[model samples]
Target: MTSSTQAVELQSFLSQITDRDKGLTAACAAIAEIGAAAAEMAELIALGRLYGSIGAATDHKNTDGDVQKQLDLIADEKFIAALRRAPVAVVVSEELNEPLVLNEGAPIVVAIDPLDGSSNIDANVSIGTIFSILPVLPGAGEPTAHFLQPGRVQLAAGFAVYGPQTSLVLAIAGKTQIFTFDRRVGAFIRTSADVQIKEDATEYAINASNYRHWDPSVKIFIDDCVKGADGPFGRNYNMRWIASLVAEAYRILLRGGLFLYPGDHREGYADGRLRLCYEANPMALVAENAGGAATDGHRRILDILPASIHVRSPLIFGSVWLVDLVSRFYADPHFSPERAPLFAQRGLMRG
Candidate 1:
């Protein structure tokens, strides 16, 4: 064909693909659709809002609900349904016993904590949804397709925190941004620019009583940070321990901090506490994308994939510099370990 003829054909083809119809071919364009779904879910959750009334009903497993007010099944149903309508292939929710396959052939899979931080719901504290998205294999069908996908393969991950005003934060690839709902305009407006983590921080969060059962690497890092001039970190570090992942993440994002939930030896607590699919995967995405870090106290959290939906893992995620310091403490051998049973016969304090 002549050059002129080729140019004419290209123009015609480009005209055929308008902005409204080109979303699927472009990931950025597709974000609006996802944001819309998230907003709908958030709105539905805002309905019947209450203080101390969230996990009110007895769950089906014949066990006490994880929190006092997890009874808001209606809100969860709406959010799960909203996710189902998207191009998601599988959805693993905190509320479900097993993963729910959305479509057999869709390219996207999402794992969600429908309601995080419900324990503090009565206090009207910040609670929200955490989600991780990964692409599905072309022909894997529904069985075991999700568990095999590594966390590094996530396409998009985010959370919708229902605080005084709902905030939706997203990390697509490595770009982190925040969208806040404008109650007056009734739309989510992009408010925050690129989020950056401070190079160092004074605050760290962890359940420190289990220091005995913690891996030597984590124990060393914590002990060093707290030991000030006598230890490797050489700086006095403060500690905070809020059990809520969303709340902890928000606090870190607002200021600068670190949070660790490492493997412990408590009964039925072998792999630490947080659910990997929903909590670790999504928060890792946010932290890393926002110039921070996320890990299992040994390796990056987003680098590991789950073998099951409810699989739990040790999570130590926060400021990039702080995480790197923790990793260095793990790498070095000179630090004093909080526990030495697995290696050295006795602690230095032992007679």
Candidate 2:
């Protein structure tokens, strides 16, 4: 109604969404710890910059040819130590093959991608860390559904992007907020768009060689993006694919864009590249809370159940209009929709 009334209402609305959640206070304190330990990773990055020394050649990856640096492990361990002091009961990380029960007395459990986009470090590219907080299980309280819970059950989530200036984006259920690091105060200050996502976007990112391996919905979207300022979409769309989760997500959040790392035929990529709890869940939380969306090119990321903390999945996120359109493509009989390439092309799409 009135300006002052609207301001009060807005503050009230924002507070209720953020404060009403139970574990939020604990989350804030934990993030403070995270902020401090992250400095260690930052120091490592800077040190590497000076000596040009990274992980040894023996520190290769178990999955692919990507370079796994020494700093990566260092960052993970430091992060674990800081998290160990929190009210956390369990912890899961992409670095470790299994979950680590840091404290038996804690309530919430945490899953994290300790150093996302690590490969970019050697190349001096932007990188980050991602985390999902949710309730553990039985004996867990209402706001408690965050720690030990699966990605699907995630009650809270967020990511820390270490670019030129470190920044954090968080989603607490219904709303999202972005905060930037203040070097002087050594604290994160609220900044940028109030975590609201654009309804639609004029950009898209996906690795295109897997075109043939993609399901129908993915193919259709990729075609539209590449088609650019043409086709039914009308607006020109730029294409991007850095193969870095944090960089891709940060780009989308800073301005507006769509990113897809969907299931493909690549070896070890049956489910997808990104882990559900560490990557997708946090992306989903922030995306949806920002008024955008995140999905597995099928269902909402927040809705997909995780059989384990380290489960992996295909991720397609950003721009609510784009996401809703993907949902429609999957649901519609005419949108090249099907389970696999065979049916998607020869049967399901043969009108």
Candidate 3:
């Protein structure tokens, strides 16, 4: 753990890691470039409408078929440009339909969501950039082949949240650290060197509007949570839905909670909306490093291999205990104590 008085800069921290592990030299460089881009993005986000309708819709649609926003395009350009200066061989971005090769023989490949939570852009809510870095395979046949490996092999993963304060949450070398952007010094200052998610929490976040579309297991979990102190879990629970993954994740890391975006019956959302490579995988790495857990209801998010660059996956992450409970619901449909008549009036597990 780092003391507040130490005041480590982001670049200094990355440099120290590179010095210790020469193998991570390229990955550390890439992360530094990403932080630089994020700092610039924070400035633009602060400008908001003064930047001339940054939230306005663009005619272009992303690879996922979601309409692109003006800020999305700009963010993509900024990050791609920054990555081009680093030792990056290829970039798989949410905005681009195909993987872009920046350097044929570079040491690393990056998968990124340049602008996450664009839906909240116009509303002036929190949004962020998510990225995962992987080593370029020695004999990889194609550029896309570099990204097919499971999330566990990632060299580094992190996200930059542009909210009340620009914050960077990173997972590298089996550790999770946080940095706050200090505009005065034009750099990120390390705030927390070691972050651990609490094992339990009283809060949960999910889109209640999708309740009708969820599977029985997910419905049962939420139902019990809604019952509060009388529920099978036997504790009062608070609900939250920010419609922004990064914001939700930041909150969970700070305090503790559960955030579920499970696959539902909706046509385009059967596999869940978040992309596997850029969004879910990176977030899963960060969560796990912070002592939390992440899964796709039945399986670990880090274990799932991406069939394609743009494939989607269900995401349920946060407090380890809460995540485990949700997994139990999915693993055994009949395991719902709330559905049993014996526990109708009171919870099976008491506080």
Candidate 4:
């Protein structure tokens, strides 16, 4: 198991999963190209201030209403250029208002967040790329409608995180795999296979600064966690907030923890902050493939269909125990916060 022969390179791995289908093969090729491009971006990011103040916000905002960074545009261009060279029909990005038509009649459609957590670039924190690939359904109406399909139908989904080490995490069909860039070989080397989550959650991640804007249920949940060993949960919990989805996801996949971005009563946050397609869907598929679970509080995330390409939704995902507990809170609007101790019996305190 220690030999390099046992380690699969990205090309060989894609070839095995593509199954000789021309369209799928092309789609995997495009994803691999994206990985290569991201690896190059990682190198540039490691150059620090020499990368030309990439952390500076541009004068523009993306479709998600987030301020754009110089690196975001560059990453988008890299992904768009790579995808256009493949047999991709539609390209949807978090930064674009409308889908870009590539090979109009091609069989695959791609949705991407080229430089996720770009805000962390200047801070030298981890950031990465996220993407989802789906087959273009026959007899589509508006081509953009095809991208709104549920996460359950994704053909392949993955992300590449650029941190102290460059890593690519992928989920294809029912399998999840992890690869680390090996500078010696100039290729992504398989590091973990069939990755899965085990529910031993001792940590939770969320932006607690929005406590006043959160719903009662979210407030109660955090309060219970804060109570720690003296609280109803009967165990101390560490709080974490990286503000970067890629970094957060990488940590959760490595060690079990619950991550929440619940919908609050804020002006525009009723539906939560993350996009359904490129952000939540791809991550949901990856979580599900890893033996974890994902939900929008009340329902499994993979089962929810997107109303639009850029629709937002609350995302709560991680080990099954925590995800199911959050869903229970959503299921019972009458549940009182005073009953937090009782809820713990069904959650963290459970055997």
TM-score, every prediction: 0.78, 0.82, 0.95, 0.93
Best by TM-score: 3
Candidate 2 per-residue C-alpha lDDT over 1-351 given as tens digits, one digit per residue, 9 for 90 to 100: 001222122223335554766656555546666766765566566666585565443355523345567767777888899998887777777777667777776656788888887767777777888888776687644322333344556666777777777777666656676666666665556665455655445667787878888777677767765665455454567788786787787778766778888887767787888888788888888787777888886787888777665668888888776676676666762563234454333331232
Q: Write the per-residue lDDT of candidate 1 for residues 151-242, one digit (tens) a residue.
A: 87777677878777788777764656666777676667655646666654678999888898876777767777678646544456778876
Predicted structure 1: lDDT: 0.67
- Rank candidates, lDDT, best first: 3, 4, 2, 1
Off by over 4 Å in 4: 1-5, 20-23, 333-351
Error of 1 at 219 (Å): 3.5
Candidate 4 local lDDT, 1-351, one digit each (tens) = 112335889888888778765546866877788788878888888887896878888998999888999899888998899888888899999989999998988888999999998878888899999999998878898878889788999988989999999999998868678889988898998898888876878888999999999987888778878997787566789999988998898888888889999999989999999998999999999898988899999888988989999999999999887787677668774454346654545554632
Q: Higher-lDDT candidate among 3 and 4?
A: 3
Residue pairs with colliding backbones in model 1 are 52-122, 54-69, 54-70, 54-71, 55-69, 55-70, 55-71, 56-71
- By TM-score, is 1 or 4 better? 4
**Per-candidate clashes, comma-separated:** 8, 12, 0, 0
Error of 3 at 48 (Å): 0.8
